[model samples]
Target: MHCFKEKICLIQIATDKEAHLIDPFEIKAAPFFIRVLESSDVMTVFHGADFDIRTLDREYQARVKNLFDTEIACRFLGVRERGLGALLKKHFNVDANKKFQAFQCGCQ
Candidate 1:
């Protein structure tokens, strides 16, 4: 992980076999994360949120208000699968062909 304080850029370089290339400049300029933090009326939503929240908190000292967890929402809605891809497919008929699904397990 790399962070540039001057630019407020936080980056992660995946060195694993299925390493993904991300542009830190693009991420730094993306408005979604910061905009969600700054919004008073719009609540930040997440699914399987623990790690995400921790990273955002550590990196930006961001405090999320009115957080809605999709997994929890799925439970409330009685959905069979709470995984993001599964839920997306079931609800929105969207298919995400994830290439790095096993990247975290070092499986590449």
Candidate 2:
């Protein structure tokens, strides 16, 4: 299934000082958070934003403002590998969990 068809089980947000994982299923303040996404002052950054932006609009009717897509930036910067997992590993020495790798990008 495409990303639009997939349920957003979690929403991950990271800052310079902290990271947070929010379970959409468990949250009562989802509307409040959606408002935050729609705010022009809050710049929301995404690795590969095409699907994420579409999904947000489809699911929450939230239109994100002031978006900075890093994958596009990497492309313009001429980074050979543009995938999030690859970039994270190359730049941060972090190994992303592979358990969900097989399920990504509408792979059967």
Candidate 3:
């Protein structure tokens, strides 16, 4: 899940059945989706998230009651390896390709 400013530009939502991308540029899912996200019962998950969470509160005027931050959990567990890439390799033996990380928002 990634966002630019207050609006989420790209979101990858998944379940046991399937997964889909909600591109606000192409779809009008923000208003409804933001309501769902603001629900106290809904737990939002993120990996090493920081500003995104703050932006949701500051810009979107929304609050997430339950948040599962992988980095925070790792810190709680006292794990020396905290990066998502390192954790994936350590636990699941998967290598994450960080190709899209270098891309800037609105970049061609």
Q: Which predicted model would earn the best lDDT?
A: 2
**Clash count list over all predictions:** 0, 0, 0
Better of 1 and 3 by lDDT: 3
- Superposition error at 71 for model 2 (Å): 0.4
Tens-digit lDDT string for candidate 1 (27-51): 5543555566556786566788777
Whole-model lDDT per candidate? 0.63, 0.84, 0.74
Per TM-score, the best of the predicted structures is: 2
Candidate 2 Cα misplacement greater than 4 A, ranges: 1-4, 101-108
Model 1 scores a C-alpha lDDT of: 0.63
Q: Which stretches of candidate 3 lie over 4 Å from their true place?
A: 1-8
* Candidate numbers sorted by TM-score from highest down: 2, 3, 1
Order the numbered candidates by lDDT, best leading: 2, 3, 1
The residue-by-residue lDDT of candidate 3 on 1-108, one tens digit each, is: 333334444677666788788765787766776787777887777887686677666655767667789999999999998999999999999999988754555433
Off by over 4 Å in 1: 1-35, 100-108
Worst 10 residues of 3 by lDDT: 1-10
- Cα lDDT for residue 38, candidate 1: 53
TM-score of each model, paired residue for residue: 0.58, 0.85, 0.77
